[model samples]
Target: MSLRCLIVDDSARFLEAARTLLERDGVPVVGVASSGAEALSRAAELVPDVVLVDLDLDGESGLDVAAELARCVSSVIILISTHSLEDFQELVAASPARGFVHKSALSARAIRGVLGENGTGSAP
Candidate 1:
């Protein structure tokens, strides 16, 4: 089954670009949110198969959002950022999110590789 994605990023520019890119790459983007509240609401409404949250959500941690999303949905949660993975390796390991995907390398293939077929998360 294909993953129906939701993107959560505080940047409007990044949101548009990411939605466009994911769609072009054949990942159906179900929704986009720019805030923690919005992301929660959209996830409840869309029940997407995957959610990609930016590491910096205008000062709020994306890992926080990922935790909440993981609590309620079976969807795969991926942390995406311009930051290096090593920078957030510990946090990512501790998070309930399935995996991390750099924003520059965001793609359906990358996401799939991280999630695998079951989409079970990686927790520290």
Candidate 2:
């Protein structure tokens, strides 16, 4: 089955662009949220297979959101950011998220790799 995805980013442009790119790349995007509140609301409804949350969400903390999401859902969480991974490597490793994906490196393959899928099937 195609993985259901939810995108959480404060940038309207990134949300739209990411949605388009991910859909075209065969990721089944279920919802988009522009803020932490909207993300939580949508997550309750979508229950997506994966969630791509930007590491920086305006004034709010994405790590905080990640921790809350892990408690609230069964989906795998992957953190994304325009900043370098070296900047937040330790925090990302400590968070409940499965992994970190640079915004520039966001792709279906990268996401699946995190989930241990090789396109044929999920990892054993």
In TM-score terms, candidate 2 sits at: 0.93
Per-residue lDDT for 41-84 in model 2, tens only?
Answer: 89989999999999999888899888888998888899999999
lDDT of 1 at 75: 82
lDDT agreement with native, every candidate: 0.89, 0.90
Where model 1 places Cα greater than 4 Å from the true spot, the runs are 117-124
Best by TM-score: 2
Lowest summed lDDT over 10 consecutive residues: which window, candidate 1?
Answer: 115-124
Model 2 lDDT vs. the true structure? 0.90
Model 2, backbone clash pairs (residues 3+ apart or across chains), number: 0
- The residue pairs in collision within model 2 are none
